[model samples]
Target: MSAARVPGYAELLTAADAPVLQVRGDWTLAHYRPLAEQVEGLRTRLGAGIRIDTEGLGALDTAGARLLHSLLGGERLAALAADAGALSGERRALLRAVAAAMETAVAEPAPPAGSAIGDVLEHVGIAMLTFRQHVVALAGFIGITLESGLRMLLQPRRWRPTALAANLERTALDAVPIVALLTFLVGAVVAFLGATVLANFGASIFTVDLVAYSFLREFGVLLTAIIVAGRTASAFTAQIGSMRANEEIDAIRVLGLDPIDLLVLPRVLALLLALPMLTFVAMVSGIVGGMLVCAVKLDISPVMFLSVVQNNVGLSHFLVGIAKAPIFAFLIAVIGCLEGFRVSGSAQSVGEHTTSAVVQSIFIVIVVDAVAALFCMEMEW
Candidate 1:
């Protein structure tokens, strides 16, 4: 650039203790190197405390700004004072604005503690809403199942025989031996206890009648139902839950198969068919166990024990036990299948619901039996 009239340089300004460096023009690479060297010399003596006076800069370019950046880091430049009044009109506006912003940033206040508490409350509200959604979904599922079951009563052709057979085998045949064995042991233990209590009353011979009537009337059916609930109810829930998790239930629906007919009705029908058969097996085995206890402990012959049981244990007691089997079967199948279908898209949910199905089935069975017993007592049969 040619020599031009420069501003802000006075002889008196150099006489002060502070150094005055003149900027030739709008900074160029050629002018920048000498200015940078001078700034470096000042930096060695003054560190970052050196002031950059942008006054009298004839013109400035990126080269000058870069040299200034090298002389003062952004933070140091923020702290440095600029001779705003002495600077060129544009440069004065830019420097003063940047310093003002830096000052505002440094003085900005932190948010209050109440704002943090509000954020926590917002998160808690969201969590509660999510929980409510899940509860509603579960309630809707139960309602749908019941509605579907009632509708199927008017159209029974949807229930396939083959599916019913499979469900029967799973819920009944597989469970028979276990149910029979448990009830047999229970009957034997009960008979032994009865004989021990009655011997003190001089009525040891009555153990055979006590064991037979109790087993045929109540313990046999109740024990079988409890066992099936633990075994078959849990199995049904797990099987259906697995189908749900693998999206098989959705596939069945897409293929025009009603999940209730294809999955639930079959299980219910099977359990209804299977439970009575299992209960019969349990009753027979339990009587046999009682006979064994009578022969060994009470010194009663097996024939005498059988005769006593036949004489005292009426057909009505056996009928009462058999009658409860169908109701118990229905509860076990329906609750188990319903819980299975209720499984969410998680393995933990499947397990939790499976356990709930077994527990709920057993609880319902006991409640029903209690009601039945109260009715029987009222009728005095």
Candidate 2:
């Protein structure tokens, strides 16, 4: 067992018709907790001609003096300070000071607590503000790019055809395998789902129509655009972010050449040119995959599938899908190049901006695609 603690205290005693309270132990801030607890009930004991004995007390501090003042009123404390041998000179001065200051101290009112609804509203407001900021930034960037593009149009010598070609190859031809493969797999999955569902209605042959319509109008361009957004957008951001990190963008500026023209324009133009072609390839690949599934599972031959697609699906659906390509392409390239320019010197910043580019591109593409789908439905095209 541990030894008992030496806590600060006050003990009362009665002698000669007078109550005596003896205060003892180290009454500094460190020991104030126990000291305060011990003296909690001592207030009721104070009566006429009460004697407070402080000579037995251990080390005393300002906190101790304040406790002493609280036990006895300021008058009694002042009286204690004035008395002979009651306290040391320094302690007496401290007690007198505490009594004087505590007399003038005013407590401020407490602040109101926050509520759940207020906190939720605050977060929503902040999100809306951030969204507005992003919209404004995107619009400004678009304007700057458009202005630069117009300048290049007026002056054809400034066009970086070589850079555009290189970016096109990277963003288009290099990406064909993944884009084609993913759409092909998705097409097969769609076909499987359609066949299983349509078979229940004794209309399994309509699976060909379903697959053709989906791939030609919606899935083809939408899937290709989404894939390119995730693939090409991130690449563009990383490339330009690297240049920014290495200060090559600065060097280009120092060399008196426009970074927008030399870097941004080429990537933007490349994506603008590449996405449509990729969309075409994706459409073909998806249809072929779906056709293969139809041939194997539904016993539908390639010739019949082609005939059904040609006779049933109009040229309008294909046109509707292809028309969205340039818009998706432009948005993805701008988002990517914009995020790349946003990158600071750090590798972490490059990575963060690259991720932002991909997310923004994909989000924008999906939203626009949805809106286009709605518009097309309303127009009956």
Candidate 3:
């Protein structure tokens, strides 16, 4: 094998009228480091009448040409090629191409400027438009999903019991411990706060009513739905998005299978089944936790707690909370599945859609719950 070639070097010479820089040797990537340093040093000391002599220039590559062009200003570098008459034809062409590329890159138009308030307004307007588009798309997806679900409902043989059961196990059974634990802790905290505050008014017994009303009318179902939105919605998006990225969804379509029926329906049905049950579990667990706190801190017996809950927190509150669950479940599932379907054929796309599914599900759930609460209040439910 040939011995490794010596890297390029530069020599600076001062003349009567101007300074001259002589470049030599194999100016390729292998010889780049020292050449770059020398070029940078020359750049700082470069004067108005400086000239580059490339008579000894050898084995020039794009990297070396770019380095040389960068060391000299663009117009000045072109002048060097014209005046020096020493650069080889190939090296001169490379320098010109690099100079042109640099010029194009630097020629990008400046961003428009505006007042801070105007900029803020512009961003808000764009956000509102994007949000409108998202709402329309999601509404369309929900309609299509509902139509598909109805068609499957009318066909007994089309029901996917196996898939539904599997999803139920994954979404409901697997989530039970965490859901119960979280609600239990939240319930205990609420009870403690109630007892402490109501004690000042000599109405510690009212703590039972507070715990029961909050859990049954809001906390139980709302907390359950939020958890489901984060866990199950993201899972659905990731699973479906992966299928899309791998072309599994396309294969299903080619096989004359309805992607909505085979993939989305079972998951949606399972969530619809799971969420209400989870909410019920959350209610029971949270109420029990509150009862324990009341018993310990407020001298309220379990019997007394149950009696107060029954008398003061009516069945209507429980019914109202439970009614919200199925609606929330349907929205979460549809948003998840819809975002999944939107994923392009890339891992990054799957990841992006998965995150979007979680955010959209949680946002929609909160908005729907708020609207439902206002409607319920207006109706005196």
Candidate 4:
């Protein structure tokens, strides 16, 4: 058998004005370690004016070619290509390919830096654009829902009473105990705080007015809306998103059915009917709790508490609160259904859209409440 050839080595020759690096022997991976170390040592000492002579190279491979190309750098390799005698046609082609690849691997330019105020302004602009897009989408969804609702009203046979009833039971009846319990506790806490503050001024009796005004005008509908937004809205998104992910919505469309009417109308109608009733229940529960607290802590009788609430709290306040409930319910249902339609065909998409639905429902409910509050204030309601 023939003896195995020795690994490659690089020799720096400094005899001429420009230094010359000569490569020789087998340059394959099996003999590449010593060649790599020798090339690396010569890399720093070599200058742009250095000449690489690869004519003596034997058994060259991709690894060796890469090592040599990197040692010479792209500019130097390009310059060396003109002198074709120094490398074989195959080695020359390999070197050219490596240089071209290295050139393409150049990093992208760094982003420009800006002042702190400029960065803040840029972020604000982006946020405003995103908000505008969200608002536009919501408005489009509302228009579609309204169109469906009008069509349903014109054709009463299209109504899904069973689905509406089921959703109503899920969103309202099952939710009653928690809504009442939460509002009741909040009412008691408000009464306690009001009594503590008013006692310093010797007007603890005003605590009944405080609790009644707050619950009847704000807390009742607002708390119920928030609860429904978190619970029913998320449920709507998850259910519809799962259906969308499974292509059931597409199947409905294929069967000549409108997904908006079949899927969204039931939820919207249910919430419209349910929210007002739940808000009324919340108002009553909260008032009862406040009455209990006043009776126990402020030495006020239940009859006197009811008399004060009846005399001081206007019917308009209850009307204002109840009026906001349907609007909030509409928005929550629309947002949930809209997000569900946005879902992609994946389990992850369902989860992400469900979360988005709850967040958007809550946010829009708050915005609507704020706007209504401002309108009521201006009108002196």
Candidate 5:
């Protein structure tokens, strides 16, 4: 029969006809299902001479192929079946050619262990390489930063007051309450701990000295910087990293804007200005917390606690802490902006860089603090 004029299936079959059945049509699972059922009726009558003539079939999906095999009693039945096509093109190729062969359909293959391990190693290698690339980029960025800063300093006219003030306000004024509250609690806890330990030795009076000296010398500034680093550094990385991902950084460059000047500088300046002020607030709140602990635990009057702090802690200690504020600010801003700029294509990259920014900022803060401590110790300041 001509391919286009394959019989409407029912006409080709008769109870009296030999068991050999010539099937035709689209040969889909839907069409073939009814015909397979009809075969059962013929089974009791004549017998099975089932010859599935697929020559006239236009197409066969995977489901149709499986149904065909099932009708044939599987592979042994498949040996009995014959193709209907006669020297047809690939498009009209036999069922085996059209559909993937079913090999006792079973479990899906497990993913290769070596391939998975290779994939993990590849990702790890990419991360390590990206880190190295970023370190080099950061070194270059630092050079650019120093050059820009120096130029801005030399030509004070280049410095925009609005930009500086805006940055300062964001970094300083907005961060005050959180910094204050955190420092206050830290100071209170320290004072309580010191008072408890010292009280055991009948040296509770020294709690004031401990709180005052620690806060002014290190804890107040370090804690405040760390908080800001975690909060604002991550923010900077996320913001700039997202912009980088979206190609806004490229747009800025196209517009002849120095992204560092337009973006990083303001943030850096704001952080530098804000950090010292935040540190001052932290110190004040911490002293107040110490006073609370002293009043409750040490039976020290507020006036006496204040008097002890004033006597034991000097202006130099406060100045030293304040000095570290700018350094911490620079580290936070630089590390945060560097991380943001490091972001490549994916959301995952942004997350990694943001995490790196926080970690690196905190690490640099501690390193700077250690150095400052050594300097202070050497000078006996």
Candidate 6:
């Protein structure tokens, strides 16, 4: 640019007793700094029905068109550019292009302001929505499982006894040792705690009653269910989730096979058959543990422990704990299998769904157990 070139300027002037902006200069990149300053002050006159006169406007590059575009704004700039008498075609196109760029370009918006209460409410709302969606999915899975189970029951020839037996051995037989060991240790701990507490009241012998009542009513089935949920539920999910990830489930569908029969029923039937038996094993093992503790601490014999349990704890307490097993088993199996089917055909999705299955199974088991406890207490059972 020549040193004698006029710097861009927007001057407010009066014409016909109304304010007008007069844009003049070579608004090239070299003139941008001064032009920017000029437009900054003159921007306030915009939208006041102020007319802009670019009739004598000269030597505008994009930089200059930008300055004029801002001063005139989009509508006024377009009108000025549109007027055949106002500018040459090249200048008009430059102004139009600059105006289009200025108008179409947008800066990203800022995030909404947050307050303590608003953040808390937002989190609570999200949690509630997530929980609702989970419930809906669980209910749908349950419906599908029930329908499939009912259909299988109607078709006796379709029974897969081999699958049922294999699953039972895996779930029930394989789990027995761990279940017995854990319950036995827990029972001994419970007895020891009971003896320590009751001894202060000179009622240490009631430790048998304490162990029996707790084991028969809650700990037996609850522990067994939790163990199964953690162990077998994860297995179920990983097995089926891998199937989904490998497209094996898809292949099964293509082959007109019902995966519910080949996969779900076997696991579901196994757990249902296995859990109650494990509950029984848990109860027996736990009572044996309490018996050993009683014999050691209170000098009460195993016979006395048995006698106290038989006399004081009714059959109903055992029934109460055992009755919840099938429900827990069904929920655990269905949740594990449902999460498996939810896999998004990826290894990562399989891993995620597997973990989800375990968490959901454990959570549902605990919730059901708590609700049953409340109901049984209210019923005086």
Model 5 agreement with the true structure over 1-381: per-residue lDDT tens digits: 564444224224444545445545544555666756755454344334544444455455555555555544554234433333432344334445423356545779997667878999999999999879867876888888878787777877667778778767767888888999999999999999998899889999999999988999899899999999999999999999999999999999999978887788878888888898899999999999999988987789999988887887779888888889988998799889988988996899999999999998898799889988998899988
Listed in order, each prediction's TM-score against the native is: 0.64, 0.74, 0.77, 0.88, 0.68, 0.75
Q: Name the candidate, 4 or 6, with the larger lDDT value.
A: 6
Clashing pairs in 1: 26-59, 26-60
lDDT (10s digit) by residue, model 4, range 1-381: 211265677888996579888877777788778878887898888876776776677777778777777777777877765567776678778778877887788798999988999999999999999889889999999999999899889998888999999999999999999999999999999999999999999999999999999988889999999999999999999899999988999999999999999999999999999999999999999999999999999999999999998898899999999999999989999999998999998999989988888888888888888999999999999
- Candidate number achieving the greatest TM-score relative to the actual structure: 4
RMSD of each: 12.1, 5.2, 4.8, 3.1, 7.0, 5.5
Give me the overall lDDT of model 6: 0.89
Model 5 steric clash total: 3
Count of steric clashes across candidates, in order: 2, 0, 0, 0, 3, 0
lDDT of 2 by residue, 1-381 (tens): 111234567888998978888877767888888778766778666886988888777777788878888888778888988876987788788888998988888988898898999999999999999889878989999999999999999998898889989999999999899989988998899989999999999999888888888988889999999899889999989999999999999999999999888988999899889989999998899999899999999999999999999998899888998999999999999999999989989999999999999889989999999999999999999
- Model 1, span 1-50: residue lDDT tens: 44333321211124245654334444555575567766676444443223
> How much is 338 displaced in model 4, in angstroms?
0.9
Stretches off by above 4 angstroms in model 5 are 1-134, 238-248, 314-316, 342-356, 367-381
The local distance difference test score of model 1 is: 0.76
Model 1, runs deviating above 4 Å: 1-157
What do the candidate models score in CA lDDT, each in turn? 0.76, 0.88, 0.89, 0.88, 0.78, 0.89
Candidate 2, residue 33: CA error in Å? 11
Cα lDDT tens digits for candidate 6, 269-368 = 9999999999999999899899999999899998887888888889999999899999999999999999898999888998898899888888988999
Cα-based RMSD of candidate 1: 12.1
Q: If the candidates were sorted by their TM-score against the true structure, best first, what order would they fall in? A: 4, 3, 6, 2, 5, 1
